[model samples]
Target: MRGRKELEKYWGRPYTDTRDWSIYNERLVRRGEFYLSLDFIDHWTDLVSRMNTGKPGRPFHYPEPFITWMAFIHVFLQMPYRQMEGFTRKLSIFIPSLVSADYTTLFRRIKRLDISLRVDPTILSRNVIIAVDSTGIKVTNRGEWMREKWRVRRGWIKVHAMIDIETNQILGLEVTDESVQDDARCIPLLDQVQQHCGREHTIRRLLADGAYDRNEIFNTLEKRGILSGIKTRTDAATRSTGSPYRAECVRERVRLGGYREWAQDIDYGMRWKAEGVFSSGKRIFGETVRATSKEGMIREVKMKMNCYNMLLTMVK
Candidate 1:
């Protein structure tokens, strides 16, 4: 209610004109009754109606801008919903750009919004190379362990990610418990890549460690016309036969003149991108311990993924 003049100043300035500020302003008003006159609020509500939802029902109580703003605060501050709600209220007094909403309302709206996933095709398609890896997040109660060990105790939830070689954008992400094997996680992510690309015969290559060296994984890739650049593991019998899975073999197979040389090269350089995505998720959105029960954990993982997707969309 106090920041109307500042908001007006921001509205009057011209910039890249990428965002539809009129719509953004309307949403801001719904979050709190701004101190502005009725004319401004009316202009915003009219713009909101024209955004084209033909469903006959009450309009969204929390407008789009408010939702977007709440999401931004949630991620930027890395705070829980209640903390975020309190911060928004305090911020609204001096920051005209800020809008405040109740904590319960913010939580409900976040759970309901079905944010779309948007990945750039150019990044995914360039060179047809992908680096696959997985990292862990905590999901269970480990407060006892933390107290005993004098450190943070946590259950692990693994996020398997595939990153583009050229652009370093996350191409795909799949969440599972820490107990799930890496190879099992990779299978669905491969399917996701195919599904998202909308191609039946995209010839992309995957690079990964020996954890993905199973014959089934390789065979699956071969069937899909994708070249597997995963490092090979030596069986005991094969080792006894004097045929070892040597570094040269790996280098040669992934060498410039070899079957998966380019794939290996791309993978080696960009494998850390997947880890970086995990770190960013945890650091920015407090994605550490989500829910206690298995079902709750699954739902929390989806929410975190949604949050990650939204942040990526906003930044890019």
Candidate 2:
């Protein structure tokens, strides 16, 4: 065993970080440009014309894209609406044709905005594996002060998401109150994955931690013909508790000696991509929701995720 270890060490090459720091740094710098982007202004008139063509109420003075850009700037830069309004008014000083939305307009338009994930077209042509997980974003950032002064409990909302392991793009997202369980979201997330990937694509597998270990989850995946790489509970039994597939999974893990061996066989390490995504999202967007209302908070989270996906594409 000692000789084998020495031979393995001699033959194996330790992986090195070969990333191009300059290009990566450049991409990060470009993120700032999105916050201040004026390219949308070129098509501003046409967008408004189409938007106002047959509308019932008063025609929109500011285009939806411009409103969306303001919203994006707000979330990405963590700037308040009033500050965003000031920023836009400042921009209009240089570009005489620019029309700025005030804080109230910004707030109303952002809440009413319909945000959706912009998935890559290539995902439709290939079989995919997905990792599923959820994380909590604070409902309000006043937790410390509120707790100290008012003795009130500050709550959080859950952001449940599924990502393509190959592309590291979010396939589906569901925003719920923190009371929603991880296992309960699996099927809905799977449905959303299908919606984004379309009828032609196949989900080859799913990877998740033991938080998703449940008979219903296993059976749902089994029916869809997708391999489940969800880690079973430590004391999982081979005996069927309702789902034979779950029993079989437990048996397979037992046969492989332990979780580590099973993980190797299934390449379960890829599940960390979900966690990495959550970390990246939190780092970029912060852990708190800026909106106080439930509806506004939901829209805010969705918009941030949409921006997150856009940022991912930019880096690629």
Candidate 3:
């Protein structure tokens, strides 16, 4: 892959928008107002909030629905607690619920929220092909200036995501520290799909990579009657390991000349869609997490995913 400097020529250095902005100025301005137009976005945040009922003690200042909405804004804007607190404070007059909000309140609400991202209904209506992959998210967002000034390097957290190929929407997600292996996440992601889609939902295919080539992983998919388009590593034990299902996958690749041909035959190249998911995530939300503690790290990543689903729902 080309580094940023090397890729500069491809970006058309002296860039300009070819489209006429004058014709679309009003529409573009209205589009940017989506965030300020709370009523327009309320439907999305309400769905997640309504799932959890309010507590049974002396009442809280803000309802769960309001808490849920504000928390999501934190992720959507990729803002820190202080920035989020200030943002809502400015809007306090427009929204009565924001009058009492503070950074700690927003923090606590997200920490406790039990997040579940549903498969889009249209995607659910038909069979699914899910792509599974993982990527590293850094602990801090340091631009070139900061890196050069401080010579700083930070640790990363791994995000395992399952994307519904057709919808191009994340169906489920898991986050862990950098030490966790990619293979460890495969089964958990599959289980999440089963939970969301139910027995009636047919999972037609599974796409993954060489890291998930273990025996149990293949067998698990076999039991579900899913055809796996996992790119297998070439090895002599290809004949000896696991069940015929696994061996057949390898043999088929060997027979088709090589990995390239096998991929083209089965549309295995679509596995890169999972990679595209990670790239889009990092590009939209920045490639780092702001949380310091383990639990906080997990919660922050999960909130980003929940925000992704909400954005997908709203756009669709």
Error of 3 at 131 (Å): 1.0
Q: lDDT winner among the candidates?
A: 2
TM values, all candidates: 0.64, 0.88, 0.79
Best by TM-score: 2
Better of 1 and 3 by TM-score: 3
Clashing residue pairs found in predicted model 2: none
For model 1, name the residue pairs that clash: 254-261
TM-score, candidate number 2? 0.88
Q: Tens-digit lDDT track for model 1 on 212-312?
A: 87666766776676766676653312222332333434445544644345433545535556667667677755656545677556656655665555444
Name model 2 segments beyond 4 Å from true: 1-23, 123-125, 143-150
lDDT by residue for model 2 (93-137), tens: 999889977889888887788887777746444788899999999
Residue by residue across 165-284, what tens digits does model 3's lDDT show?
Answer: 866678768888888898998899888887777766788888888888887888888888999888788773457466667887888888898877787788776788889878877776
RMSD of each predicted structure? 13.6, 4.4, 6.5
Can you tell me which runs of candidate 3 are displaced by over 4 Å? 1-34, 40-56, 95-100, 142-154, 236-238
Whole-model lDDT per candidate: 0.61, 0.85, 0.74
